[model samples]
Target: MNILLYTWLGSYTDDDIERHIRGMGINCRRIEDTQVCNGDRYHNDEFCRSFEKILEDADYDCVFTTNFLPLIARVCYKKDIPYIAWSYDSPPNLASLEEMDHPTNHIFFFSKDDVEDYRSQGLDTVWHMPLAVDTDKWDAIKTAGRDIDVSLVGRLYSSTLPVLMSRMSAEQQQFFKTLTDLQLKTYDRNILKEFITDGIAQEICRTYEADEDATLRPTRKQLLYSASTYVSHLDRLLLLRVLSKKFDTHLYSTDTEADYKSMLPNVKFHGPVSYEKGMPEVFKSSKVNLCPIFRENVSGIPLRILDVCGCGSFVLSSFCPEVAEYFREGKEAVMYRSAEEAFEKVEYYLKHGDERESIARGGYERVKADFSYDDRIRRMLTQAGVLKK
Candidate 1:
């Protein structure tokens, strides 16, 4: 089967995905259009016209992308080709799902909650597929040694927090604080939504200077969820600060100028690393990879946890039911309910080298055996009816 792999800047998994697709004996050609792919001019007619021009010459069975691209979906629908999108982001903007009802679109989300919600809306092509890793690339990475005791490789979301909080009133701020406190303590289910009343949500939207016309903007629930994610970012910053005090914690992100940097002076901060080259080494060299999942992700496992496991490194991730559903908690991976619990596990696993290595081995084997990109893409193709089972 022939596939057109659409890619853009900051596509963490595209290279590995393209390699794995070719390894499966599929004819996969990759195309990069920075304009539309970066989301800067995604909806522009110029981008769509340019993209269509490229597609006109290439004969392919299907089009594939890492995330939902509406323009591509429209073009594929016109061409009578299936447009398959594997969404790795949690709670992908509701606008993207506007095309869920499109007959030629096959959209896969990492979050089961999202899939169920869309399915309930009568979008049968929407499926729940958890994120996967390229085990071969991760397994081949070699590091000098495990120098870092604990490491986190992700964004600080520093820009999102202040902007969100600035728009909230004092009452709204207090409500949000209370809600996030409860959410940080609770796991398995999202309790933040329970705390949101329509009145409170409306007030928040008003305070945030949102568009007066409800039809032109995101719903109050989406606004509230966005705020809660800011809270989750704060929680991550706090956890890193606390952990850095006691453990040799290392942070790798481009967000170094955030206010949290001043407080985390002792914490080791490294500039951003490319996914294909540098990220695997960070996982390999860290005694424990810390995965503080975004607060918005209720039950979905973050890709970081899977990537760390693929690197054969011990991962201590925040509580996510999906993690437990896929791997033995204490054997293949470790889960923590709170920041304190995460720190405690970090200390325990650091001292117990043999147990940590065993769990890492188990995680690596599990991912290699069942969660590789080759396996995931083949399944996606079959579901899209491009490949016969």
Candidate 2:
């Protein structure tokens, strides 16, 4: 079978995914030209025409990508070629979910919640498949002998909620503040949607500066995103701050914020590390790799968590329903429900070297057995009917 593997920049698994596809004895044609990944995303008339031309020129049995590309979906639907998309991110950027119901389109999401949402609406084209890892590649990298204690390697998103909050009076501000605190304590779902009514939306809009967006009512999703972004920010901030005080914490991100310096006084902040070279070593060398997932990603296990485990490292992450479901909790990995619990867990794991290493080995074995990229790609292709002769 022949496949056209499309890719975009900033995705972590394009190259390794291609390797796995080819490793399955399939002819995989990789497309990373500026036209596809760098050019028009979706809904551009001329761009769509150009993409159709490219697709027509390179005729293949199927087209695959790291995430769903609506432009490809529409073109593939018209051309009658199967298009398979496996999402690594939760709430995948649903750029124009046009032609979503096409028989030739098989959209896979890592999050069961998202799959349920779409499938519940009678959309059978969607499937729930958790993210996979290329353990062989990570296993090849050499470790640096557990130099770091606790580490988090990602961006620290600053929320826009403060901007909206700035527009409100003290009373309204207090209400939203309390709501945020309560919402932060909650898990798995976006609690902001429950309270952001149309009247409240109007009040927020009234206070919101017209120059910013001129819109009257903020959508529930918009409010959820703002609050979630801030919540994610606070989540990571709190985790790192607490962990730093007790352990030799390190952060490998582009977060140069002044507040982070004062907040995490004992933490070491290093520059961003690439997904390929630097990360595996960091993961192997770190005693406890921190993975505080963005709360907006409701149920999907983030790719970073898989990568960390794939590298044979111990990860102490926030409580993700899917993570707990897939791996053995105390045996393969450790899950913490709250910041206080996270600190306590880290404290225990750091002192107990043998237990920590045993958990890491178990996690590595579990990931290798159940989360191999080669097996996942084959499963996706088979289900999509691309491999049906």
Candidate 3:
């Protein structure tokens, strides 16, 4: 099959996806169009015209992207070409779903909830495909002995919170505090929306100087999502802070120095690491890799867990429903429901080396057997009707 891998520059997943497609022995050509990629007006006439011209010139049987592109979907619909989009993020931008029902669009989402939601709306083309790991790259890294007791590699979401919170009054601050506590304690459901009414969200938006345009105003769902992310940031920081007090903890991220110095002074913070060179080594060397699911992703499993497992590292992840679906709970991987439980498990695993190594081996075997990039891409292509059994 001849495939055009449509991508945006600077996207972290595009390189991996392109590599996987070519590995499947398909003739793949990649085209990066910044205008259609980074632009805000994806549904505008100019974008459609530019994208249509590009699609017409590229001679390929199918077009595939890491995420949904509405303009591309529209052009493919008109040209009668299949457009396969595999989305990695959850709660996809509402605009992406507008052209979802187009005949030529085959959309895949990582979250089961998202797939069910679209299916309920009568879109049969949408499928739930969980994210997989590039075991080929990950397994090549030599397992140099475990150096760090526990490690986490990702964003802290510290950049936006202070600015947003600075505008609120004491009452609003207290209200948000209570809501975050509820979000931290609760699981599966987005409790922030149940507690934060539309009026309260508008008031908070006003304080933040949100634009007066109705389109720009934050909806209750958006506010709840923000609150949930804020809670996740705080929860992660708290977990690291307390875990550091008892055992060595390392944080690999681009978090600002001031935030770490003030909040988690004892925890070691390293600069961000790329997936190709640095992450596999970190995972291989860490005794425990922490996978704290963002609160906004109620049941979706983060890619970090899969990557860690693929590297043959012990992972203690925050509870997610999908985790149970993929791996056995205490045997292949460990799941923690709360911060206290996470810390307790970390201590137990650190002391019992045999048990930890056994679980890590189990996770690695499971991922290699069932969740490799090659397997995932083949299934995706088959679903898109680009590959035959």
Query: Please, what is the TM-score per model?
Result: 0.90, 0.92, 0.90
lDDT per residue (tens digit) for residues 118-229 in model 1: 7887888889888898887776788898999999898877434345555666776677777777776776667766566667666666655653433322355665567667
Query: How accurate locally, in lDDT, is each candidate?
Result: 0.81, 0.83, 0.81
Best candidate, TM-score:
2
TM-score, predicted candidate 2 vs. hidden true structure: 0.92
Per-residue alpha-carbon lDDT of model 2 for 314-375, expressed as tens digits? Answer: 98888889998999998888888788999899989989999999999999999999998877
Model 3 agreement with the true structure over 1-389: per-residue lDDT tens digits? 78988885445678888898888788898988765666763567887787678777867788888778877888888888889988877766655457778888888888887787689878987888888887778878886699899999988874244445556767888887787887787655667756878798788777656434323455666666678778888878888987999999999999857857688988888999988879889999999999988776756667888889989889999888888888998889999878888889999999998999999999999888988778778887888777887
Better of 2 and 3 by lDDT: 2
Task: Judge candidate 1 at residue 219 and give its lDDT.
Answer: 59
lDDT of 2 at 192: 66
